[model samples]
Target: MVQNGQVFKILVVDDEMSMRELLEILLLKHGYDVRCAESGSSGIEAIRSDPPDLVITDIRMEPVNGIEVLKKCKAVSPRTIVIMISAYASTELAVEAMNEGAYDYFPKPFNNEELLSVISNALRNRGEEQSVSDSREGLLYFGCLIGESAPMLKVYETIQRVAKTGSNVVITGESGTGKELVARAIHRQSARRDRPLVIVNCGGVPENLVESELFGYRKGAFTGAASDRKGLVEAARGGTLFLDEIGELTPVLQVKLLRLVQDKTIKMVGGTEEIPVDVRIISATNRDLERMVMEKTFREDLYYRLNVLHIRVPPLRDRREDIPVLARYFLSKFTKDLGKEIHKVSSYAMDILCNYEFPGNVRELEHIIERGVAMESSRIILPDSLTLSMHRRKEQERTVPAVRSEIPIENFDLDKHMAEIERRMLQQALSQAGGVKLKAARLLGISFRSFRYRLLKHELATEDELKEE
Candidate 1:
């Protein structure tokens, strides 16, 4: 039985002495209890005697190859993680290993860091799998989003049910909960899979310019409108028009949008002709449109039109079961993209991630993992590698009280103090909004562009900071 913080026992099975020795030394250096077997048959004997927590085996062993070793390991101890290594890596072999339940496949001449990362991830996953109930083991993935929790399962079901329909969809969720991904999934699964999915950020466009941006302008529609421009609605002609941050649209634009939704037609900003658009509307927002309707901030008619087929995505905290899986998914993604060797988040780091309130949701988690992968020199991302906003919030909470007690009226710098206040407020809003700049701006009663400017002014966070949220 593995104890918390105790070294994990790893079995290395390889006919090549150098490979076995190298892995043994590496595991030992990393504080793992390492054992080596010269052949697959010996490895199986060792497993039968006492199964280690993980097995690393090379393919092409004389009588018993890595595949057989993997099978025998599973037969002996189902919980043990088996990783296959091969000098001649092929698509077929990789698929075979995965089909046979290998934790991961590593090609020969694999980067040492990458190998270690994969080992760490496998071990972590094994631990998680052991703890998780069998019913919750299988997670369904749609494009980029991954989850197996009940809420996510329901979401998957809803997506499958509604994807084939032409009903307008309204996806509501806390920012970073992957609303856009859901929209794309719907479009992909829908009959319009071949057509373009036109996207328009309601909050990203200027208030004065949104109308023209959504409903294209003819030449001379405005001072800068020198040529006929196709609006987003027209651009989406036979496909889907994804309206992100739908609640950010001005009241005037909302009325215009209501018309488009009611009658699949759009009038160009300057042109008199009403162009018929054959687009399926899919809008997403983090705002409560119903509440906005009650307050008269959002038109009730528009809200009704857009809410025909609603999908409310649960926040990250609401689906904690998915964190470990998502973390590993992101770890694999960033590691491969960066061409880095980092493979896994340490169990401690994973705990921290799973426990921390991800105000920015999946997007925030992705940023955290990306940073961890970039900064971590070791294969495993430990707790220290994670720079959680919760820590920063705690520090702010501690320091604010002290500052309040110590401030003097005589030596006050209003400019600096106000700027600091603004920065802190912005940070708090971002945290509350789950690292979504548009949502943060809305929380602050400001425009998205202004919020961006403030972020730049304060050097607080970057545009990349709110990526995909």
Candidate 2:
């Protein structure tokens, strides 16, 4: 369609001449600059020579299928949105096409109005996405962190600024906010990138062993010290050492660590000589170290040493705009690991994710998407596929109205009351979902299998009517 003095170009690819002509006429009638490709190979060539604003390709083309064409379009021009159509559409093929970067998939004989609407919306969104990308070029940092939110951009700028120095850094954030990732980014961007970067969780190890873990021990220094052993600090010599949960370090261990940070040398346990070492210390903590210092819990002197350069990772809830990017990233990651074909997350599912206050932060989002990919049976992740936290579930359950009691407490028939309420909910959910059991199941936050079983239990539908979804 023409907008802002520029006409949107659309390429229609199909083996059937009639189908191609029909699409070309339809698209041209809508004012789109339309081109026809009789085969997927030609479609790929057209995309390479002059990438269109959008592509409409049939999935079953010979020599090169729509999935291949989609991949080539993404490779050649990532902004070129693709829509896949197939007369013989299957979930597997749809999933593969979506994972390969098709904007949407349609079964053959699709509604004309729906197809046109999708095309219009896709191009509009493509324009908006291009604008956003242009505004925030190089949004991804260190090939690991992803976001263009204000909080994340600030973090990226700080990483770039501090990564050049050898000063000790303290990364503060909630437990799952990716503090370790920020530490890794700092180390990767720092001068010691070529050297070893060792990570140790201060809270994971026992308090008794933390001292020896941070400073090497001599042979026969203790009963279990069978031979001379190098500590994690020594292992990180000439590079960087990431101490996660630095606030969890015991007072005595903190003193030992403070000396190392102060002197740049460590005296092995039961050894007289102090060995000099060069390393940048990056410590991360979810706790309020400042409060702990006031409370006389954490050592202030050590805190100052690690706080020379500070970075605070914003929680996922604070950067809701990043949820879509993070969710897609995790989807791509888990799909390959689980050998699942799922790629796209439904708009409804994404809405649920973006609205969620992820108490567990980015790590929780990763787990949610990973679980979604594993649980999803279709090409797109639906609301029913997402399994949020139990706390959130409980919170949702609280929002649901309590069942009204019609009988006196002494005469209450608990079982019958519960059954009646259950039946009523089932009917209401079914009605609201427009007789679609899957949607009804999602509405009630129940599984399709469970909904079907309940339907049988309550005689809501016959066996034939409630067959496998």
Candidate 3:
């Protein structure tokens, strides 16, 4: 590989001498043209003097920081890829770096294999970006999703590979992560593109009616069965059946679904006939089905059958690099749809979007952009037009008074006190919402997943507690 003349020049910037030496040795062993800088100032100078293909910089440095280095690199060499590293990594710092155009971020004491993989990916992506730039085309878009971020590129690759296969697929991700869009993409790319793509919201169906909804029922099957009805499975013959929120299927429904998945046939309610169906199964869930299987809530056989091929859609916060492109894409789409004259998003608005932790993922971002487009009177969207949840969070944060008590700082346990206060507030919210998690989350002005995570963190609600509510 080294003789093939594909080596990439890499620059490592760290305040510690040992770190610089270690990274240089590691990169050199891998047949790379490696350079090292012991300070952020020197790294900036080197970048301006002779830009490398990639720069690996420590976030915490003297006189200048990694964020500054990343800014300088972007300004001097727009094509150069920069990866930020730090022993002290926070969501805020990571968001800042990504918004400032860092290629990726990694915490200190990183795994060798993972770092190597990231470096290889960064080099490969640099080539792809250069090619796109040469052609004057925008970011690579697959179906409804538009992104050139590494995570999104991987997702696109996976979709292309799996689309041609007949294997069952399980798409896992947080809610509003476009799991359905992925299912549609797979169907559009598959051999069954011309055929029906039936979507069944598994959670929306009533438990008592799920069986009949999935399997056709005879005219006299039940009290309300005035006419015979074909089920979602039969409707999707020779096509794809996308089961959204598969985890919501009860144990009995899971067993029935498992049998259908295993046999490719369904038996209708009050019907002795076993109707064969030719369809691909693609299921999506936001819940942890593995834990559910272990807990005996979901069937293990069903889980395995649905998980023949898995695609995980990464949450939006993890792929902040794609926010600008996505925001622009949404802006264009909504403008045309709504017949607005909006042409672009202001840099300040884009920065706000990039810094936000989108608990609702891509769907939330799209909604925000749509709202912004609708609200904006001018061609450009400003920061005020973009009403994000983070703004609400900031307002809420400002309302809380500072710690003012007759207690010494050394003797006071501020963290513990805050935890107790949070726990009590959550409990009160749940009580006020009548133990409904969604309502409680809304009452708290937070996302349901965020509320659920806090509930898990504080051990506030057991499975049984949730069920009872």
Candidate 4:
């Protein structure tokens, strides 16, 4: 495939001449620069002379095997992507190839379309990495948000376009996806940059006090009002007011908020006059406001008034390509904050993170990296430092003991081995349940008291967990 007027080169290595010719024709038809290697030895020679963008090689070959060729290619050019194809593919071989740094493995008689898609994605990821590497701090970082993915670029463009105007904006996304950061970016780029940007959590304020809290109360308006006080709306004059979780506003509060949005005016509690306020309204919500309006939970008029412009913050799973960049960014931030010298995340740890589906989005990733930095005793963060809740971690736990069981009796120390296994299981259960002792205890099929005892025994419980109990 071609990118930026440069054709991607693919090297196909196979012992069979027909297989080599077949792949060459298939790749060449798809507008790629195809090169053929008749054997693993030839593949290594070709890679040394000129490293291609990607390599597709068969696993079995006489003398020099494809695994050896993979090692040589990676050693020669670490950025080169390798895909292994074999007729005799097994779980062990596939796992071995992956652990040895192969990008992906394909069994014989694989779907042509699937292979093409995999190649496209691998090259695209490499390109994205190259782009981010070129201007890491400048290109990808927008205010507090960090990402170079297409979704984020769209969000950035929308922010810039809408920031110049005074029109209302509604940002919708899942929680922890950085909707507030988008609001901040818009405010920062607007004409009222120097003015105060007042923030109000619509859901956090008490229903009884929300009206007075939003609109100022005149002197003796209520029992506690000894004098006139400006509310959030008035305090944000000539600036912007950010309403977070706007969906949580009660019907009465929604009416007051709607009045403010409609006429740029607000009425103080127990006051007779309407006060004009020249503040731009920016609202954010994790709930679906459209659905709320249809259900008559949120006012329809206020929905349109606030949603004149819309922006959706993409979740972390949708932008997996940025995980490494964000991980490194957080690594740098936490390292300096904690006064640590940790430099990077181990390759396996990063792989684990990238493959994970972050249900809590970017905010969760930030916390993960911070914990990794704090937990790591070495210069690099390893898989053990990452507290992930993925099912794959459970699978890994099951596989570990099986591998350990195969260790020679002479080399095995039963006490140490048993202790290690117990420590890992406790940590895994705790992490999976997000450090909730009761849930973790249930996962281990034990009582809370027993779980607490085991945690103390293994030193796996955090000080916070202990204190909470």
Candidate 5:
């Protein structure tokens, strides 16, 4: 008997014979119980009988297209993951697919990594329970941070081991990447689970109050110290203290923190006694402390002290495979919160969310889902509810996505249209400006920023030199 968690059953529906055969072979080789349909009609029938963990389909197909397949899957199983693939490159079409109900769209001539990324995300998003469910402390699944991608699985395993240690840990990732959640998970699994878990936002506090916040203040210590106050560290005594955004600590604050971590004691303001506090310190930050240390913005000593047990939260883009589950989690959250009985996301909408580069990470995704809940009148969240600025400046290229794309289309050119439009616009602006940024800005009726942006984009000037000229 096929059981859940032993092996996942995946479905691939495509009109093209080669595409269907190739995907089935790949999935089967990977130990998945894979099923395929050459047309949407057969695919729908298969799903109605035995629902699959995930579905991958081609946007352009015969008789029954991928769109139809996506609708049917959602109708039968709202949480079933769906990915749409197309040979034609079109953002307008992709946006439409997202609105329609597909989890993500893969442009043809894609990379193997890209296709795999989409598939992984789609499946991770499938969090629907086919039967009656149970919840603990408002969590759909306790101590479960779901992701099947290699990087996330590694993180999961690391968490299992690290939770046993009382040593300090540094959890790192981009904003909205769920650092706090990871910290809490660690705290929940730790020996001090019965003790209180204290959280202090290093970046959110004012500089003047930081010292007192970490170390208790005597009644007459400062202006606000009308009564003796116990700092977060003291409150977390015999438990755990979660310091988020640790890299934001100033040099002065870092010295105090270092003393606490190094000496195992904190001196209260205006108090002569050195109070030894027993607490597990788990620090999190999106910033690169190593780079910050080189820049002299962060303390290297403090970083090493907290880096003993490190848990890195991979960004949503890095593990697109997890997007589906995370999205569904957010959906269920909003559904209950909004008192709306929504069942599933449109296949197309799911496609856009799974494929897009969520620069803001999972937090950004949570916001999107919340917005979708408000906008969605019916049960399913529509892709149009997503407010990502596709035209915004490309995200910083410091780190490549952790997971690569899957299902690369052979001989397909990537981002050709966007490049073509950009080339024509730059050439026209230069012609109007006679190769001057200011002149081009005036001719294009754009700001100096726009003119400089075009010049820098077309390599007419270096990024740094663009402002100088």
Candidate 6:
């Protein structure tokens, strides 16, 4: 009733024609476009005819149960959400329906109000999802913040819980870890979602103009202020203002920002009038704000104000298991963007990516995929497609004597060929570096950290321990 077709286009499927008609009449009277199907086969046919936005079908129906209908809908037109209804919504039936992709299930003689509310909420969420899907460029980030690590799961759960609230959020993570994504996601899910979401890089803005940029400027505010200009805060009214690198804000700017948070008002530069504003603040910083506060560079009070809710994005190395998922996602994105035919990564290439510690996190992985898509000739991507600097470092590591403790061949009877290669490589690296462990690691093209791990794993002795012996 509020908006036509803007709401869910619903199809009512049931063995009883009376039930179908009653549902259709009830929904249509309330301003929903409703259709009726008396049998499972008919419902499936109607779905194939033109998929409805939502399907409400009875479970335990003749010929095809709700599960079959749900599965067919999922396979045929996955976007159409399915809701199951039955005379008895037993646990088993509900589970089966849900497992087969039913969005929800209602028992016969449903509580009409609850059913309506549930339907409305589902429809609203579906609308939100569709809107997000449209905005997703080539690459997509759910929660915009990417991570599949256990630590990241906690972060995702927190985002979902806190996004609906109007409270401020402070995101902390190393650089290139997608802090902006988290801020954007919170804005997209917030009450002010319909409003504009603006971003300001606090570190890059000049100290003298930071205040003016954040809180508008009058025509005569400064030498370059030719006309009245709205600041990011005013522009982001009723929405969110993301402040990146908050640790870089000058002491003077910090006080002003804190005032805005406390009073929900901003005074344009060189203007006496105070403008009442409603803007949610989402701040992020890679720097140690706590340490900065200790050094008196940042105000402790301001830190507390921005830290209302905190979400930390983990480094990509910590979530190696998600590398392939992200890689494939990016590959598909770039393939379409670059118009390349590359479809997949070779297993060996995948192994290299998973094991490598991605210092630049998701952003770096995206670049690698983009590069691979450009360089790949075969339909499948190979390791050479990625200019992974780390692999060169790995080979250098394999050459170090400290890479593995030298076990006398007789002392460490091992696979003949593998042991022979290990001894020869170690000896060559030692000879090349004059047996200097640090130099040996460098010649081997590996970091001391990586060499250390390999040495211990291989039960190889370090030259330092050998000298002590």
The predictions' CA RMSDs to the true structure, in order, are: 13.8, 17.3, 13.6, 12.4, 14.2, 20.3
State each model's CA lDDT, in order: 0.79, 0.81, 0.80, 0.82, 0.74, 0.74
Residue runs of model 3 more than 4 Å from their true location after superposition? 1-140, 392-469
Clash count for candidate 1 is 3
- Residue 317 accuracy (lDDT) in model 1: 84
Model 3 agreement with the true structure over 1-469: per-residue lDDT tens digits: 0433677888999999888988988889988899898889999999999999899999999889999999999999998988888888554676577677776667778777668876785577565565675353335445476777899889999999999898999999988878998999999999999999998887633454567778878888865566787888999999999999999897878877877899888888878888888889999999998999999899888889999999999988788988877887888789999998776575445656777777678888899999998987666676667774546431233222234455542324688667767777787787677556798899999999889888877876546434433
> By how many angstroms RMSD does model 5 differ from the true structure?
14.2
- Could you tell me how far off, in angstroms, the CA of residue 61 lies in candidate 4 after the best superposition? 26
Q: Write the per-residue lDDT of candidate 6 for residues 368-409, one digit (tens) a residue.
A: 888888987667666667875536422233221323456643
Runs off by more than 4 Å, candidate 2: 1-123, 126-139, 388-469
* Candidate 3 local distance difference test against the native: 0.80
| Model 6: lDDT of residue 61 | 83
- What's the distance in Å from true for residue 198, model 2? 1.1
Where in model 5 is the C-alpha error above 4 Å? 1-144, 388-469
Question: What residue runs in model 4 are displaced by over 4 Å at the alpha carbon?
Answer: 1-140, 388-469
TM-score for each candidate, following the candidate numbering: 0.60, 0.60, 0.57, 0.59, 0.58, 0.54
Question: Which ten-residue region of model 4 has the weakest summed lDDT?
Answer: 394-403
lDDT computed for candidate 2: 0.81
The residue-by-residue lDDT of candidate 4 on 1-469, one tens digit each, is 8866889989999998888888998899999999999889989999999999999999989988889989999999999999998888454665556667788777788778778977886888685675675465424445577887898888999999999988999999988889999999999999999998998887633454567668978888865567887788998999999999999999989999889999889999879899999899999999999999999999999999999999999888788888888888899999999999876675556767887777677887899999988987767676667874532531332112322766653324678688877777876786577556688799999998888888888755445436634
* Two-way lDDT contest, 2 vs 5, winner: 2
Residue 380 in candidate 4 has what lDDT?
68
